[model samples]
Target: MALSARELWRILEPVHGMIYFVPEAQERFAALGLDRMAGYFASRAAALGPVSGEVVVATFYNFNPVIVHAAVPAAWSVTTPAALVEARYEAVGAALRRGLGELADDVSELAGLVRGAAERACEVPQGRPLFAAHAALAWPEDPLLVLWHGQTLLREFRGDGHVAALLLEGLSGIEALVVHAASGEVSAEALRRSRGWSEAEWADAVEGLRSRGVLDAEGGLSEAGLAVRARVEGLTDSAAEVAYAGLGEGERERFVELARPLSRAVVASGMLPFAKR
Candidate 1:
C-alpha cells in the first residue's frame, strides 16, 4: 500500500512512544531517579536544550503550562544538557536493547537507514520549534541510539506541526482533545487527566464542541466534526511534508520497510502501550 502521511505516522508513532510511554522505559527512568513528570521534563529538556517552563509548555502543546512547569525542575536542577543527553541516550538504548535484543541484532543493522531518514528530515528548512531543535542536535554514534533519536525527531516534527494546525483551526486544548477523542486517537478521560483539566472543565469543553457542531450528543464526531478533523490532519501532513521531501524516489518506502520490523519488535516486546490499528 502506498502510505499516506497519516499512515506513515502510525508506523512511526509507537516506535517513538516506546521510549517515553513504555512501562519498562518509565521504570528505567525512575531507577535513574526521575518520577513520572520529571522524566518528561528531563527527556524533553535534554532534547530541547535548557529551555524555560513556558517554552516546554508551548512545544508540548496539550498539557497545561502549570503542569509543565511542575516538571521543569527535573531537567534544570538534576542534569546539565550535556549530561542529560548522554543519560537520555543511555536510558533509551537500555530500554530498546532489552526490548529488541537478538531480534534487532546491533545498532549497525539499522544505523544507515536511520541516518538517511534523519539527514533527509533535517533538510526541511521550516519546522515547528520542537522539531527544529531536535533536528539540530548532533546524531549519536551508536546506531541503535541514533535510530531512536531519529524517530524521536520525526515524531516531534509531526507533533509540532499538528499543534500548529490545531491552533490555526481555532481549537482550544480541551476542544482539541474532544476532537481527538471523537476520532479515537486518545480516550477523552485520559487526555483530560493528562492535561490536568478538571472533570467539570472537560464536560464543559465537550458541550462546547457539541454546541459548535463538532461533536454529537454521544460525544462522537459529527460529519462537520470529521471534516474539521480531516482538515487539521491535512494541514499537519502538509506542514510535515518538508522533512520527507528530501528522500530520494524510493527511499521513503525503503526506509519504512527497514523500520517496520524494528518498530514491530519494539511493539511486540510489550514495551509500549500503543494498540495496533
Candidate 2:
C-alpha cells in the first residue's frame, strides 16, 4: 500500500513531539531562567533569531497573543536565541537517549531518510516561515538529533500548510480550535485553556461557527462542518506531499517502517502522556 502524507506524519510525529512533554526540556530551560510557558515560546521560536511575540503569534497561529507576548522578547532578555536552541537540542538528546535507550544507536539510516525529505521540503520555503527558520539552522551530527530535527522541520512545514488551509476555509484561529474540539479528539476546554482563551471567547467562537453552519445545535460538527474539515485536512495533506517527492514509494514505506518502532518507543516511554494528535 502507498503511504499517505497523514500516515507518514502519524508515524513520525511522536518523535518530534516528545520534546514538548519531556522533563529534560523544562529543566534545561529553567536553568536558563525561563519558566514553562516562556521556555516553550523561546525554545521553539529560537530558530527564528529572537523575533517578537507578534511574529510568533502570526506564525504559530493558535496561541493567544497575550500569552505569546508575555513570554517572547522577554525571553530574549534572559538568554540568547543561540543558547536557547542549544538548550532545546541538549534536552531532546537527553530525553531521547533515556527514552529510546539502545534504539538510539541505530538511527543513522532513519536520520538520512527523514533528512532527505526535510531538505527537499526546505527547497520550497516560500510561505513556511517556521520551517524555513529551522531549515536554516546548522544540522546536528548525532543521528538521533538529526531525526528529531528532520521531523521537526516536516511538522512545521505541514503546520504551515494547515494554517493556510484553515484560512482558505475562512476559519479564525479560535474557530479552528473549535472545529478541532468538535471532532471529539480533544476537548474544547483543554484547547481553550491551553491556548489561553477565556470561556466567553471560546463560546463566542462556537457561536460564530454555529452561525456559519460549521457547528450544530449540539456543538458537534454538522454535515457541512464535517465536509469543511475534510477539505482542510485534504488540502493540508496535499501541501505536505512535496516533502516526499524525492522518495520512491518503497523508500517512503521504508521510512515509515523504520520510524514506527521509534515513535512507538517514544510513546511507550511515558514521556508524552500529555501529547495529543
Candidate 3:
C-alpha cells in the first residue's frame, strides 16, 4: 500500500507533540524562567539564519499573530542565541532521558526503531526552511535524542508547508481554524478564545468561509470545504515528500512500522491528547 498522508501524520505528530508534554521538558523550561515558550522555540528554530519576527509571523500563519509577537520579546531580550540553542538541546536531552527511563524495558528496542525513522527521514531533502535549519544543527551524541530532533525537523517542515498551502488556498489564520473546527478537529469557540481572536473577528472569518463554500450555515464543512482541505493536505504531503525521497514503498512501510510502537508509547505516556472521534 502507498504511504498516505494520514499515515505519515500518525507517524510524525506524536514525536512532535511529545516534547511539550514531557515533564522533564516542562521542568527545564521552568528552570530557565521562561513563560509561554512554545512560540519562542518555534521562532528561534525557524530563524534558519537570523530572521525577524515579522517574517516568522508571516510564515507561521495558523497561530494567533499575538502569540508570535509575544515570543519576539523573549527571543530578543531574555536569551542569547547560544543560550537558547543550548537550552533547546539540553531540554530535549533531558526529556528523552526521562522518557527513556520511564520506558526502560523497551529502551534498546525503541532506540533502534526511532533511530531508523530518523535515518530514513534524513534521506529526504529539508524542503521547509525551519526544518532545514534544525536539520543543519549537530546531531546529539545519544541516538534517541538524535531521533527526537529528526522527528522535530520533519514536523516543522510539514508545518511550514501546511501554512504555505493554506495561504495558497486563500484561508486566513482565523479561517483556517474555522475550517478545522468545521471538520471537528476542535470547537470553534475554543479555538477562537485560545487564538485570542475577538468574537467579531471569528464570526467574520466564519462568514468568509461560508461565502467561499468551505463552510455551511451551521459552521460545518460543506463538500466543497472538504475538497479544499483535501487539497491542502495533498499539497502538504507533496511538499513533505522531499524528506522521504530515498525511502521506497517498502522502506516507507518499514519506517512507519518501526515508528508505530514508539508513537503508541508516546501516547500511552500521556504526552499527547488523543481525541476520540
In model 1, which runs have C-alpha deviations exceeding 4 angstroms?
A: 23-28, 31-33, 73-75, 106-110, 125-127, 274-277
Superior by lDDT: candidate 1 or candidate 2: 2
Report how far residue 244 has shifted in candidate 2, in Å: 0.8
- State which candidate, 1 or 2, has the greater TM-score: 2
The whole-model C-alpha lDDT of candidate 3 against the native structure comes to 0.66
Candidate 2, overall lDDT?
0.92
Candidate topping TM-score = 2
* TM-score of each prediction: 0.88, 0.97, 0.83
Q: What is the C-alpha lDDT of each candidate?
A: 0.73, 0.92, 0.66
lDDT score at residue 85, model 1, on the 0-100 scale: 67
Q: Give me candidate 2's TM-score against the actual structure.
A: 0.97
Give the per-residue lDDT of model 1 (tens digit) for 101-196.
874465564456555655766777374678778887888877777777877777777888888899989897677887898898788887888788
User: How does model 3 score by TM-score?
Assistant: 0.83
Q: Per-residue error at 108 for model 3, in Å?
A: 7.6
Point out where model 3 deviates above 4 Å.
37-51, 100-127, 274-277
What pairs collide in candidate 3? 124-243
